[model samples]
Target: MIEDRELQLLINDIFEYYGYDFSGYSRASFKRRVDRLYQMDGFSSFPEFLSRVRVDEAYFSRMIEEITVNVTEMFRDPAFYAVLRNEIIPVLATKPFIRIWHAGCSTGEEVYSMAILLKEANLLHKSLIYATDINTNVLDTAKSGVFPLRMMKTYSENYVAAGGREDFSNYYIANYGIAKFSSELSERMVFSQHNLVSDRSFNEFDIILCRNVLIYFDKDLQDRALHLFDDSLATLGYLALGTKETIKFSKMQEQYEQLRKEKIWKKIR
Candidate 1:
């Protein structure tokens, strides 16, 4: 087991060297990931592992990728997308233009999901999506908009369940074992690197979908991120979170009213 001092030094080294802040993440999760890295790399001692990472930048990048949660899929948790389509998009439709922030959007599946939803609703032409993640590797994958073709079967089911109007296959072309999404979907999106832990919110958005990303953060960091989201949303803007996440216990709960029990809230004040 890595000592607390060693863990602190390792976290500090990662931040100072890579500019990615894991210091605010949950200690238990952070420690578990670090231990997994140590075991995977065959390092018996944390100090020795740190010594190697200090000199091997490629290893450091891989460690960061391992430590960061990147699991996501198109229309994941179909019920949530159902609620968004049924309960939320109508509210957004009243607006002349809309800006959406897909915070921690790993590999852009959720970003494309939003675009498809907007397109089906005839709102895509007026919408702009800003997809951000701290991991550059995932961001590059997102920009390409290519996904394994095997996953499209599940995504097609999700699309149908989420009230898709057109054929699910209309959105992408199958090439070999990969599916490349339509360029029209990505033309309205801007992919960039943004760290939620240390970076301030860049623009006010009509809706913010930061799902499944905050469960790894401690309460203090969660509150900090919530405050940033609060500051970055327009009045009555929507805030969507992971199915397991809620703002009810946070300092800003009263400032937002629950639109659905499934983690969608609207700014009330």
Candidate 2:
């Protein structure tokens, strides 16, 4: 096992060399993932792994995929979506045009879910969903709007629980063990690479859903991310977070009002 200080230095070196910053992530999680990568790659020492990462661009990409967490599903924590349906979407409908930012939208499941929700609400044409993540590969998968057919059953259940009005199957076509969603759902969407740790806010938004992405970040980085969200959101805009994430400890806590049981906050200040 690499010593703690040495491992941290290696992480910093990757940031300096590759412009990929993981310093603000939880050290324990970073260590665990790095250790797993070391074992899986059969590197005799940590330094050997570092050497491969520094020189081999392909290996560095593989290393990033290993270290970053991207666990997500369609309509995850369905209650949250239900809240959005019953409460949030109605107010958003009042707007002439709605802009939703799905920060760290891994593989675009939730983005599609939001698009489907807006479609059912008769607001899809008036809305644009910007889905972003640090991983370009996942963004490519998201842009493709295709998923394994086997996961459809569960995703369908989640859709129903999230107050979906139509047959969930109406959203996609299944063939050869793959499901391709309708292009209509993807037409008003844009997928891009965005690193929360380093990227500045590009546009103001009415709603930002950054679910299940911040639990990996430590305090300072979490605060930095929250500030970025703050800067990106318009006044009275909605901000939704993962079930495990909270804004109570954040510097911007007082700037928002908890609007729903889920971690949905509205910027008031």
Query: What is the per-residue lDDT of model 2 for residues 72-111, given as tens digits with 9 covering 90 to 100?
Result: 8898889999999989999999999999999999899999
Each model's backbone clash number? 0, 0
Task: Identify the runs in model 1 with alpha carbons over 4 angstroms from their true place.
Answer: none
CA-lDDT, candidates in order: 0.91, 0.91
Give the runs in model 2 whose Cα sits over 4 Å from its true position. none
Candidate 2, TM-score vs. the true structure?
0.98
Q: List the candidates' TM-scores in order.
A: 0.96, 0.98
lDDT of 1 by residue, 70-163 (tens): 9988989888898888888988999999999999999999999999999988999999999999888899999999999999999999888887
Residue 34's C-alpha lDDT in candidate 2?
A: 88
RMSD of 2: 1.0
For candidate 2, give the lDDT of residue 240: 97
